[model samples]
Target: MRRKEDVVRGVAAGIAMAATAPYLTLKLLWLTGSHVGARDPKALDSLWTVNLLTFGMDATALALALSFVRPWGRRAPAGLVAFPMWVATGLLGTILVAVPTDALASLVLGPEHRTPDQPHLDDTIADWVFTLVYGGFGVQGLSLMTAFVLYARRRWAGLLRSRIGDLPDSPTRNVQRAFACVAALVALAVAGVRAYWAAGGEVGLPIHWVEQRTRSIATMDAAMAAMAVAATVATLVLVFRIGPGRRLRGPLTVAWLGAGSLFGWGGYQLVAFGTETTVKDLPSATPGLMNLVQAGQFTAGVLVLAVGAMALTERAVQREQPSSRAALSGTEPPRDLAAR
Candidate 1:
C-alpha cells in the first residue's frame, strides 16, 4: 500500500511539473521580448516585472512538485516545506476553484460578458493567453494538491488523524483564540467588501474597475468572499473546539486553503497595487482603500497561520510528553505499546 501511494505521488508530481510548462514558457517568452501573444508590443514593455514574478512563481511550483517525490523532501525542515506549500496552495487553489466555476456559469448563463466600449489593457492580450495560463494553473492546482496531500499524510498522519477534542488546553490556547477571533473578524470584513463588489456595488472601486467588471471577475470575487467566510468558520471551529468530536483534518484543510487564498492573492494584489500608476486602460481600485484592504487580508491570513501553528505545536508537545517522561524514568515501553 505504501509503495502504491508512492507511485501515485510520483505520477502526480510529474503532471504538476508538466503543467507549469506552458505558463513558464509564456512568461519566459515575454521576458525575452517575444511578443507572441501581445496585441501591442508596447504593452509588454512595462510588464517585465510582472512577467518575472510569475515566472518565478511557476518555477517554484515546479520545484515543489519535484520535492514531493524526491528523497530530500522527507528530510526537509517542516517549516520550509509547509510555508511554501501553504502559499502555493492559496495561490493555485483559488485558480482551481474559481476558473472552472466561472467557466461553468458563463456557459450556463450565456457568458453575460460585458466590456467597456473603449479599449482596455486586457484587450491587448490574445484570448488564448488567458486560456493557456488559467488552464495550466487549474491543472497545477489539482495535481500539486494531490501530491502535497499524499506527502503530508505520510509525514503527519497522527496529527491529521487527531480530533479537536483531543487537543489539551494550554496557556496559549486563550491567546490563540483571541488572535483567531480578530482574524475571523478581519476575514469577514474582507468578505463583506468582496461580496459587495461581486454584487456590483462600486462604492470604493476605481472607475476603471467598475467599467471593466465582467462575469468572470465577479465570479472570482464571489469565490474569494466564500473562501474568506469558509476560512473564518473553519478556524473558529478549530480554535474554539465548537464541534468537540469533529476530526481536526476537515476544518484544518478548509482553513489552510481559505487562509492561503486570502494571503496569497492579497499579497499578490498588494504588490501590484503598490506599484501601479493611474495609467489609463488598466482596471484598478482606490489606491489607499485597496492597500488597506489587501494589507488587512494579508494580516488576517498570517494570524490564522500563527494560531493554527501554535495549536499544532501544543498538540505535538502533548503527544510527546508521555514518551519523554518514560525515557527519563527508564521505563519506556515497547514500540507497539508506545504507539498506544
Candidate 2:
C-alpha cells in the first residue's frame, strides 16, 4: 500500500511539472518579442494571460507534491520551503521587474514603437530589479533541484534490497549518472549566465563579442533546454527500469510521461528561441512561436497536475483496497496483529 502511494505521488509530481510547459512557451515568446519589439498588442495580452494561468497551475502542482511528503522525512520540509521560495522569486520577477519594465518602456517610447536598440524609461531600475529577481529564481531552482535529487537518491537506495532488487553498477547507471551531471552543469551554466548578465558583462563572449551579454544568455538558455530534455528522458528511463512493485507501476509511468512532456516543451523552446532570432529575426516570428510555446507550457502544466491528481487518487484507492479485501473476507483479526 505504501508502495502504491509512492507511485501515485511520483506520478503526480511528474504531471505537475509537465503542466508548466505552455506558460513557459508563451513567456518565451513574449521575451523574444520584447527583445525585437515586433509583437502585437493582442499577442502581448495573450502572453500575460498564459503567464497568470501557468502560475496558478504551478501553485496547484506544488501543493499536490507537498501533500505526499511524510511528516518525519527530511525532504518534506525542503519541498515545502522550495515551493514558496519559487513563488516568491516568480512574483518578484513579474511584479518588480517584468511588469514595471514593460510599463515604463511603453510609457516612455509610446506603445506604437519600441525596439531593443532604443533607450526606454526605467532601464537601470528594471535591470537591477531583474538581476535580483533572477538571483532569487536561481536560488529557488537550485534548492528544488537539490531536494529532488536527494529524494530520488534516498528512495532508490531504500529499495535496493527489495524484490525488484538493486540496480547493477553498470553502463546504464553510468549513463544516467552522466545525464544527471549534465543537468547539474546546465543549471550551473544558467546561473552563470544570469550572474554575468546581472554584472553587466558582455554576452556572446567568443562568438559575437559586440552583442550585449544578454545575447550570450540565449546560448546558455539553449544549452539548458537541451540538458533539461536529456535529464527528463534519463530520469524517466531510470525510474521505469528500476522502480519496484506493480502498485507503483502506474504512478511511475505517469511520472515518466509527464517528464517526457516537459522535455519536449523545453526542446521546443530552444528551437523556437533560436528560430526567432536567426530565421524570423524577432517581433516577426516571436509572437507566433511565443503563443505556441505558452500554450505548450500550459498544457504541460495541466498534464503535470493531472499526473499529481492521478497519483493521489491511486494512493487513496490502494489504501482502501486492503481494508475492502479484509472486510470482504470477514477477517476482523486481533487488533494488535491487525495493527502490525
The collision pairs in model 1 are: none
Taking all chains together, the TM-score of candidate 1 against the true structure is 0.92
How well does each candidate superpose onto the true structure, as a TM-score? 0.92, 0.36
lDDT of 1 by residue, 106-214 (tens): 7888856444575454777998998898988888999999999999888887777778898779999899999999999999999999989888887777777677677
What's the lDDT for candidate 2?
0.40
Give one digit per residue, the lDDT tens place, for model 2 in 48-74.
544455455445434534533544444
- Displacement of the residue 239 alpha carbon in candidate 1, Å: 0.7
lDDT of each: 0.85, 0.40
